[model samples]
Target: MKADPQAQRRLLDLQAIDTALAQLAHRRRTLPEHAELDTLARELSALEDERVRAQVAVDDLDRDIARLERDIDQVRARKDKDQDRLTAGSGPARELEALQHELASLTRRQTELEDAELELMEQRETAQAALDQVTGRIDSTRQRRAEVEQTRERTLAEIASEEQFKTSARAPLANDLPADLVALYDKIRENSGGLAAALLRAGRCGGCRLELSATERGRIKAADPAEVVRCEDCRRIMVRTAESGL
Candidate 1:
């Protein structure tokens, strides 16, 4: 491509901006906050599962307690009826003996019911403790997530503003350059991780920081102004200017 020297330099500026933008994008993706948020999300999910299980345990214990209470009531009623019959003294020996046996069975059933109720109470207490812990963990995780989100939002906003500034800086170059040159620059940028062009500073390719030979520097200095030159070491478009000090 045969572009004016100044126009080609402007392309180099555009390339610099693109490089910065790419670096910023990479930083955003690899930020520590991103990984922290992911970790917190996993913990939150686990806490929610524990909370659900605790709730189910509590509900099951409640049902068990209720059933035990009903059983105790039925046993007490039977015992009361048999005691009344024994006190009436209108029954034979066999009948009285049967009443005594019924009373013993009822007493044993009541004892068993009371034991089950105590066991359920203990289980309920344990479940409540677990639920509290799980709830606390959830709240903690949510707070951390909110903090991470705020940081992410601030970082994203900063990156956007920086990108906007770069675009503004690049606007002046776009009008003077041809479409084909710009397309090539964009293509190189994509493949080079946004470092499409680099200055030949101090006889070295600034992008790769590789020093050039005496012959290579002389050749580049003697090249026609309209010719596009790439560095032999890094294959980046070489911009030779006063900044290059070559």
Candidate 2:
């Protein structure tokens, strides 16, 4: 394919910009924030599960404590009502003796209920403390996740901005080249790992980093300036310049 020598040199600039873009893409994939965010996400999921479970436990304990308190209150109410009846003295001696005996049993029952209520209250407190811990961890982890996500977003935006600039810069250079040549370059870039052209510097293919043979160098030296040349080893467009020693 025929291309002006100056236009051919611009292929190197295109290659440079493309290389920068590729590097930026790779950088986006390998950002430390990505891994950190992944880790944070996993941690947040586990913490959320734990927080939910702990909250359920705390709720269960609260219900138990409430039930125990109600039972103790009922027992106290029964005892109080019996004491009122005893004070009224509305019964004979035999009935009064029976009432006194029943009052003693009610007092014991109230003590037992109070003991059970205390145990439930202690359990509720413990469960509530555990729930608080899990909730705190969840909050902190969510905050960290947000921060890492923000950092990842900023990094991606920076890379995207640079890529846009390079793409815009490449537009006119690509437009100046022959359409067929640009098409060939694009195809080669796809097939050759994003490299369609390389500098033939100091009797070498910069793409493959392989030295040119003396006969190959002489052939390229004598070739027409407008004739497109390719690296023999890698088949990349070999662009000549003052530094190319061609």
| Highest TM-score scorer | 2
lDDT of 1 by residue, 1-246 (tens): 666677778877787777787787888788888899999889988888988998898888889889988888888898898889988978799989988888998898899889989988998999888888888888988998999999988998998899888888777776568878787777877777678777777788877898888888788888888777788876778777787655
Model 2, span 164-186: residue lDDT tens: 99899889988887888889889
- Name model 1 segments beyond 4 Å from true: 178-180, 243-246
Evaluate model 1: give its TM-score: 0.86
The per-prediction CA RMSD against the true structure, in angstroms, equals 2.4, 1.9
Cα error of candidate 1 at position 91, Å: 2.8
Error of 2 at 109 (Å): 1.9
lDDT of 2 at 15: 85
Top lDDT prediction, candidate number: 2
Model 2 CA lDDT for position 33: 96
